[model samples]
Target chain A: MSSLEKRLAAEKRFKFYGMFAMTLSLFFVLILMYKIFSTGSGAFVRTTINADVYFDPNFIEVSSNSSKKEIMKASYVDLADQVINQNHPGLDEENFIKVREMYTRKFDYQLRDYIVNNPNVIGKTVNLDISASSDLDQIVKGNYPRNVPEAQRKINDYQLSILDSLDSKGKMSKTFNFWFFTNGDSRDPETAGILGALMGSFYALLICFSFAFPIGLLASVYLEEFVKPGKITDIIEVNINNLAAVPSIVYGLLGLGMLIGVFGMPYQVPLVGGLVLGFMTLPTIIIASRASLRGVPPSIREGALAVGATKMQTVFHHVIPLSLPGTLTGTIIGMAQALGETAPLLLVGMVAFVMEIPGGAFDPATGLPSQIYLWSESAERGFLEKTSAGIMLLLSFLIIMNTVAVLVRRKLEVKW
Target chain B: MVDQNSNYALQTSEVYVHYGKKMAINNVALNFPKNEVTSLIGPSGCGKSTFLRCLNRMNDVIDICNVKGKFLLNGNVDIYSPDIQVETLREKVGMVFQKPNPFPKTIYDNVAYGPKIHGIASSQNELDEIVKDSLHRAGLYEEVKDRMDDIATGLSGGQQQRLCIARAIAIRPEIILMDEPCSALDPIATAKIEDLINELKENYTIIIVTHSMSQASRVSSKTAFFHLGNLVEYGETGKIFTKPDKEQTNDYITGRFG
Candidate 1:
């Protein structure tokens, strides 16, 4: 072959290599997305059982004249047990317990709440929807293997038969799991929701951005525009870049030693977590901000300075505005990275199993990644799906953040 | 030292520029006469632009650049005195860069920035009138009158250069220093800039640095030739082009060598 032919063949080979690499990466991403979606999709729907619960006064031990406090304090477990035994008569104690385990443990509390909220329902039959146990829910959703031996299966033959009967009668159904989005963490995965972790992550990011952005911007401006390049400035620049690459968990240790240990701040709160993550994210914002500030063409600075503007005026009026889009893009990416960070948060006490939704940044809370870590550590079959679902939520937030970064860069970047 | 002439608007003596020990401009004393266009002509890297930036202390922006000089404006004010504010000096001596460096702002804002910052205009109407008059003086108002709010970067290269000139003039400086203001333009645009310079010298003392010797002859009344960071020749434009006394100036003007 001629030399030209060899060159063309080499070009073709390079193109093919690039295409293969891109396709391989894309294939991996698709597999990951498919795995997450398939497993987590089950967590978005919950299995519920409908029952005609008769509010018997004898079982409730509450008369029509009974006070609301008396009704609330009444033995609701007995009433629920009676209702289950009435549907399946002549059951031994073991079978009875198995049947009772099909519904959520909190059904008694739910029944008491219902009666206290509605006093006129006494002595009348009311149709109600009850939450199923996590094991029964996994079975109902077909996520659990049914062909396994009776000893191996979580739902045994008898319980399966009862569930099949309920299914046949259309009393057992799958509904949108609105509770999964609204409730906080729970030992029972069926009742678990992301609202607590989501809020914790939100507050942490809010605090992180509010703390890091202005300080990072000002530091970068001072270093990039005002300070002369010398031994100290050079040392500072090198250390700032080095901090960006340091293990984030080290920042957590620093936060633990200083913010919690020395300052005596509360632990497991997003405020502390946010402050820790802010320390982790500060170097990133400063490096990115300085880079963008450097990218602002020197001619623009000269233009402003030539107009008899002061150095501060030139920077604030021209340099900062021109670099803002890049600075913000960098800041958001840093926040996204902080959102997915777990080890630093784990050290900062954001890994605590918080069950109530955090009302404020100072409240005890766990971020989404730590929540996923907690759920993934559970030995329950139900938590497997919950883990994937939590991952999905976290990944979606990352995607949204990255998309905003790109949009901001495209929208605000001056073409000149 | 050059002769002390009261007719000169600006005078600099014993000016030396060092960039961290490497000399860029040697001791070159030159005086710019009042209301006349002077062109500093040199090849690339001859420090013509560096000398031009020294008049307003624009070189102070470079950390390693050390400029030692004595500059007198209007034969009285010591421009380099420790008490003098650099911003105030820049207000008196404005500059246009080699590139058309307009701010990424509206045409009106680009022109109004200098006046606004210097507090030359007290009211909106006064700033508007200043902007309009500057643009008209720069020969851009007629073409861009309807699009004053449009971003200045959207204009053509020549128009952007003109807008920069207008921005420099809006503060009503007595002297305008232009560093190769037409090097980035085509022939037609360069011609337009040369025409604008001729008209501007009636009010502002215009000192331009140009590489094109023909541009020096066409636009300037006096010319200074810098070679290897040294002032090789300085004389009237007519003498410099027709009968230069220095053999080096004659050789350079006759295209013998840079």
Candidate 2:
């Protein structure tokens, strides 16, 4: 072949390679998305077992003037039990226990919430659809194939008929799982939720943004404008670049050593987690902000100064406004990277099981990635679904954040 | 400090500029008379721009650009003194750059920026009046008066240059230093600016740096020629172009060599 033909052939091969690489990456992403969606989609909806929950006014002993605490202290399990006993009058003792186990572990609490929300439901028989146990949930979700022999099934022939009878009576339903959004982590997979992890991530990110953005921008401005190139500046510049490339988990170690050890703060609190994450994110923000500052043409600065404006005025009013869009884009991307980080969080003790939703930054918490890590390690099949669900949520939050950054850039970016 | 007069708009004596010890402006002295047009004409990098920048301390922004000079405003106020506030001096000596740079804002905002920053205008109506008057003085009012809110950056190059000139005048400076203002314009636009310069000299002391010798002759009464970082000649525009006193000035004028 002639030299030009050989070069053209090389160019064609490069194009094919690029296309092949893109397709390969896209195929992996799609497969991962499908697997995650199929696994976690079940978490967003939940199975419910219909039951007759009679509110006996005599049992509650709740007056209209009674405090909420007094009403809450009353037993709801006995009321639920009375309804079950009345329905199956001739049931044996062992069968009765099995029937009771079908209700969600938090059935008592769920019944109490309902009564508190509806005080007039007293002395009335209400058809309440309560959460099913994860084992029952799995059977209803078709994880336990009914075609299997009685010996090989999670639900036996007797239990299967009971479930089928409930379904035939329109007492078995699958509604959107509101508890999965509102509750926190639970050992009972039926009540496990992402709220605690979500709140922890929220508080951590809020603290991270509040501290990192201004500090990063100021550092960039000082280095780019005030400090001239010299020994001190060189050291700072080199170190900042090095910081961006350092392992993020090292920052967690720093947080553990400095915040928990020296400062004596409680472990796994969102505040310290945020501070650690902020340190990991600072170098990213600084590098991005410096790039943004560099993108502004010097002519803009000269123009402002020529108008008899002070140095500070010129920088703040002219140079900063011009670079703000790029700066914000960089900041958000950094924050997203911080959000998905898991290794550093493990170092800071964010892998612990947290049930209560965090009320403040100081509350002991676990973020989404850490929550997913903990869930995925569980031996139960239920946690596998939850882990995938947590991954989906984290990915969505990242997508939304990046979209907001893009929109902000589009709105604020000036052509000149 | 030698027999300095306070009436001339600007004066420089023994001015030197060093970029890390490499002299860009050697010892030089020049004068700009008030309410008249004076042009500095030179080849590229001859330090005419550097000398103009010293009058307003514009060189202070450059870290390596060291200026050592006696720069007198109205001839005797030592402009380079540490006691002098650079902002106040810069307010008095306004500069227009070689390229027209209008802020990426509305035409009204561009014109109002100077007045706003210096606190020269007191109220909304006063600011509007100042912007309109400045634009009128720059000879760009009639064309852009109807669309004052339109972005200044979106205007034509010649129009943008006029807007920049308007912005400079809004501050009501005593001296306007224009460095190659017409360099980026077409012939027609250059003619318009030259006409505007003739009109501006009635109120403002205009010190213009131009590479175009003919532009200098057309707009200036006094002319200074710079060569190799030194002032080669300073005289009336008519005498300097027709019968230059120095052989080097004549050589440059007659195109013998740059």
Candidate 3:
């Protein structure tokens, strides 16, 4: 072949290689997105079994005038058993207990809440929708493998038949699972929600941003604008750059040893988690802030100084304001990265199963990633969907944060 | 110490500037007469701009630049003295840069920045008056009067340069140092700036650094020639153009060599 033809062939091959690599990466991303969506979409809806529940006076020991606390202390298990027996009459004790197991453990709490809220409904036959158990929910959602033998499957033939009968009668249906967004973590997967984890992450990020943004900005400004370049400053610069590359788990270890051990901060609290994340995020923000500050043209500084502005005034008035949009973009990108981090949170005691929504940064809580991590380790079939759902939530948050960063840059960026 | 009775507006004695180990400005002593336009002409890298920066201590902003010698403002005040506040020195000696480096702010703010920082205008009305007067002096008031709130950078290059000049004059400095202010402008803009400089000589001591020999003769009464970091010639513009005292100055002006 001619030399020119050979060169053209080599160039074509190089272009093909680049295209292949791009396509390969895009393929993996598409597959990952599809898998997460497919598995997680079920968590947004749950199965409910509607029944005529008699608020039987024989089982309910509280009167209409009874306080909520007194009503809550009544025998709810008997009430639930009596209601389940009424729904499935002619069942023996064993079958009656099995039928009662079809409902969620928190179904009793739902009944109790209903009676507590509406005292006029006492002894009345009320039509109520009860949450089905996670096993029944999986069956209704077609997530459970029915092809497997009854011995190995989560639901047996008898239970499946009963679920099918309920479905045929229009008593069992799938509805939007508001509790998935409202409730906290629970041993029962059907009742678990992300509100606690969401609040935990919110408080942690709030504290993280408060601590990292100003400290990083000031540190970068002092280093980039104020400090003269010398041996000491060169060393400090190298160390700060190195800090950005350090493993975040090391920062978690530091938080555990210094913040929790030495400082006596409570374990599994968002405060310590946020402080650890802040330390992990500081170098990122500092490096980004310094880059943006350096991007400010020297002409602007000279203009301010030539106009008799002090060095501080020159930086604050002209240099800093011009670099602010870029600095904030970097800060938000760093915060987004911190939001998805899980390993460091594990070391900082944010891996605990927190059931209550965090009231403040100091309250014990688990962040979204830690909650997802905990759910992924569970043995239940229902937690599989919840794990993917939690991951989806975390990714959406990252996307939203990065979008805000881009929008802020577009809005506030100065052309010059 | 303040010296009000001196005939010269600024005088430098044996001023030497070094960028690290390399010397940029040699021993150069020159006096700028009060209320006159004096132009420094030199080829590229000849230290004319460096010497101009030394007058206002603008060289202090460079981390590696070292300037030594006596910079006496109005014959007696030592500009480089440790007791002197740099801000006050800069306020007294305003500068317009080579490029039209107006702040990315409104036209009014660009003109008002110097006076605002120096606290010269006591009220909003006073600041507005100073901004108007400075813009009028820079010959930009007629073109930009209707758009005072618009960003200064949005204007044409010539207008931006004029806005920078207005910004400098708003502080009402005694000496105005312009370093190649017309280099980035077109011929028409250059003519307008030259005319503005001619009108400004009655009120301010103007020291301009230019590469154009014709510009030096057009705007300045006195001209100084710098060659390779050394002041080679200092005379009237007519003498410097027609009959230079130094052979190198003659060679540079006559298009023989830089």
Pairs clashing within candidate 3: none
Give me the candidate number with maximum lDDT. 1
Going through the candidates in the order shown, the clash numbers are 0, 0, 0
Model 2, A1-416: lDDT tens digits are 89999999999999999999999999999999999999999888888987887777766667545678877887777766666676557668888777767777788778788878887788888888888888788889987678988887656676677778888998999989888899999998888999999999999999899989999998998888778789998999999999999998899999999999999978988898898999989998998888989988887788788889998898788877888898899999999999999988899898898999999998989999999999999977677889999999999999999999999999998886
Q: After superposition, how far is residue A42 of candidate 1 from its true place, in Å?
A: 0.4
Error of 1 at A339 (Å): 0.9
For model 3 the interface RMSD, in Å, equals 0.8
**Candidate 1 recovers what fraction of true contacts?**
0.84
Badly placed stretches (over 4 Å) of model 1 are: A1-5, A53-96, A108-126, B1-5
Model 3: lDDT equals 0.91
Q: Which pairs, if any, clash in model 1? A: none
The deviation in Å at residue A51 for candidate 3 is 1.7
Alpha-carbon RMSD to native, per candidate: 2.9, 2.0, 2.2
Candidate 3 lDDT over residue span A1-416, tens digit each: 99999999999999999999999999999999999999998899989999999998888888788988898887677788888888888998777667777899887788888998998888899998999999989988888888898899877787888888998999998889888899889999999999999999999999999999999999999999999989998998899989989888899999999998999998998898998899989999998899999999999899889888999999998898889999999999999999998877899899998888889998899999999999999998889999999999999999999999999999988886
Taking the tens digit of each residue's C-alpha lDDT, what string does model 1 give over A1-416?
A: 99999999999999999999999999999999999999998888888899888888788888767898898778789989987786668989999999898998777876887888888888999988888999999988778899999999988999999899888998997788887799899988888899999999999999999999999999999999998889999999899989999999999999899999999999999998998899999999999899999999999999999989999999999999999999999999999999999988899899988999999999999999999999999998888899999999999999999999999999999988
Q: What TM-score does chain A reach in every model?
A: 0.92, 0.95, 0.95
- Residue-level lDDT of model 2, residues B100-180, one tens digit each, is 899898999999998998999899999999999999999999999999999888998889889989998999999999999
Q: How much lDDT does each candidate structure score?
A: 0.92, 0.88, 0.91
TM-score, cand. 3: 0.96
